[model samples]
Target: MEFRCKKAGDECYGVKELTLLSEISQRLIQTKELKNDLSVILELLVRHLDAERSFLTIFNRQNSKIYIEAAYGYSSAQQARGKYDLGEGIIGRVIELARPIVVDKISESNLFLNRTQQELKSKDGKDLTFVCVPIIEESQVTGALGLLRLYNPYITKDENLYLLSVIGSLISRVVSSKQEQMEELEALRQKNQELQSKLDDGQRPVNIVGNSGKMRDVYSLVNMVAETNSTVLIRGESGIGKELIADAIHYSSKRARNNFVKVNCSALPDSLIESELFGHEKGAFTGADSRRKGRFELADGGTIFLDEIGDIPLSTQVKILRILQQREFERLGGTETIKVDVRIVAATNRNLEEAIEKGEFREDLFYRINVFPLYIPSLRERRDDIPLLVDHFIEKFNKRNGTSVKRITTSALNMLMIYSWPGNIRELENCIERACILTTDDVIHSYNLPPSLQTADSSNTQARGGLMYTVEQVEKQLIREALTSTKGNIAKAAELLSVTERMLGTRVKKYEIEAWRFKV
Candidate 1:
């Protein structure tokens, strides 16, 4: 029963040796579980080498210790007991020294710990040879492999060491790859947990569902100005949650318990805006049968949210500015001047600067209300929040409609993520609500979404010489137009786009666009 080659001067592997190695290598590559693959590999090596037993010990970088990952014949309890610190025993020393050790007699070696209680002697009472090789990856020892065999004259110690070292190298790659995959999975899990925490925090006040960087900046601004009495001007496109931000500011402020009077400047007519803001005395107007407290007076010792401030007429702006300056204003046709202590939080989707240039808005009034301007990002600017917003809206509609809708399909979510949400968060909430009403199942499929979203990209393509274009392309085109209008002036272009110069610069770089090309 000879395992060695009989040919003279033969140093290479024999036919049987080559066949066994090939089989083992293929099995290892095909195996999925690290522990199972290691166990099979150890078993194959012990049987082929005629070793009594074999085991693999893996290193834990975090704790600087080695624990048995797999053993050829040891029980689970025995394997669990095979943990060791560096240089603690024979196995540990092999890893610490980063080399191979071949002990002719285990009893004679002081380093033999026998921690797993394995039988170390042969049937004939002959001393067992202990062999250990370091598992190295990228020039560093990561683990060790141990083998025990009855001393035999048929195989040389050098031959056994060489074979074991080759196996160690193969195992090293597997261990390294497994560790890398595990680390990546752990990182992904941690990131998900962090995002979930941010979403939870966003649900606390005004239910501002977003975890994107832009939304984080908005949240920081809200926190900074919430405790102050300074007037805040919330600005963004329509449906961009400007009013929600105004509510967050008021409720989070020191006057949270006080009245939060709301006034829709656009809803009131030019003849009544002044009366709506400043209370009119009885018989002052056709509809004023009794003396009425205006939004300002009603919001005294609290806060007033002036929505769509840009819609108010210039005549009304003058009165609003007077109250902001002197904290006192006479109601329409009222002789006595009324004063109120109120914090003002105004919001508007219109571009006030453009309005002022067109003589539609008063610059003095704008300056008075723009003490602390908080710009809310539109949905397109923070697309990462779309999924969180969808989940929130779905849950909201589910509770409202008394349904059990759980989630949106993958394709449906993809469409939501890609679409340019021109109408912003409000539009998204409405879309989700509509889907909830239409969907009979728990999941909102792609077909459940509105026709506008389904054909949004195709519609853009039809407008662009029948060439398909992504949301990014539409954005780039808009940016290019703004740049051309501004003659490549980043500051002016950014102002036109309602974004900071730095943000516009980042977009230009991302799109690989040359703004200088648009210069006259």
Candidate 2:
């Protein structure tokens, strides 16, 4: 077959060139695997050109070197040996110069370095011609395409060079496209790995309890803000695990390896609050003690937890505001302005909003620290977690006191659950520890509880019986109140009563109460 060539400008008629170009284009379009398509294209070029061998070399931009990607008429071991630095051999020189090279006889050219050690002699004992053309993309050479063939008297060097350059252009496009696709996929994979690593870090064990929905929301907030250096304000009643949440935030953050300094703002006196937070120079006060680094300086590159943030004096609040805004502060008596990279996480049981309204707290300081607010629920709000907390305390006291207490009895648990935990987890823990010390048997009975709990239980029992109503009547009254609060929705009423929908339905049936009458 013969074909006319417009781009070549030769009006050429050659069967070998037409067949090689057609087969390469067809295979490239049909094949999905780039490596396999390149191998087949190289084999076909070697056969059609009547060359002893052919190979394609790709440049590694990262290493600034070229290596054989595919080859024909060479063993797999020989193909693996063709690695060249830029301008190191015949192929490298073509790529480095961004041009084509044709050695009429391999032995005559000094550029034929013979890096691959492949056979270069023809069957008739005549010298062979080596041709190499740079693969140019957007005017820059990306790689080299080369072949070795016997010297042909009929085929001029210009013709062979022109045909190879056309093929080099085609190969350059395919290789560049493939490289771009691989790079995009690799980048996506790395991004997914980083996200998964962050998730794993967030889920890592922290010494906190409870798995209620409210606590789960807290966990999500902590995970969301742990990667940033933002200020976090933890708001809740005292003994509601605000400090535990602060610990979780710091330990799960990027600065986990650094210090986590803590200071109780309410515990320090007004005279010493500023010096305690911003450090003090020698002989700054009447004590004239040695220079000491404050919480902010000690917590550089990490986090600082300021408990009871609302109780700091007004004068100290201004200094705190300056540190939050400028990230720089000076010692109590020093002139040097020290800068720090500390992450601030403050917790307070007092209502800062009310304090701000009363002009007792700085509004600017409150806004600065409240960039991320996490509110921990009180024990009364998450009542379902009480049993878990009881078990945790029991196990803890069992280990600490060397006592073999297995569990609390049903009566004791019921009493513990009904009494409002006014002091929250901290108070509950102390109560359990005292009970464990007082109990004689492995199981803690109701009588073994603290006198205050026993007295409260007795008062509750007397009030339940002295009302001159039967147990059924009292149950009916409670169910009515729950239905009223829930607007007669059985599901919500049951949730309010801490019972299942079916159980609430049975009680309504026993009392002969009309549930819909309560809805307005």
Against the unseen true structure, what C-alpha lDDT does each candidate score?
0.80, 0.80
Question: Can you write out model 2's per-residue Cα lDDT over 473-496, one digit (the tens) per residue?
Answer: 447657866887887766678879
Ten contiguous residues minimizing lDDT sum, candidate 2: 461-470
Q: Which stretches of candidate 2 lie over 4 Å from their true place?
A: 1-205, 457-501, 504-520
- Candidate 1 lDDT over 1-520, as tens digits, reads 7454543123434554565578778987787777778888888877665568888887766445577877887898778768676776888788889988998889787778777776768766878888889989999877888888777656678877887888787778887765565456656765675666566476446556776667777887898899899999999999988878888888888999999999988999888788888989999978789998888999999999999999999878888898899899887779998889999999999999999999999999999999999998888777756777898998888788889999887678877766777777888898899898888788899899988788885444123223344656557756866896887766678879997655787899987665655555
- TM-score for each model: 0.57, 0.52
What's the lDDT of the predicted structure labeled candidate 1?
Answer: 0.80
Question: Clash number for every model?
Answer: 0, 0
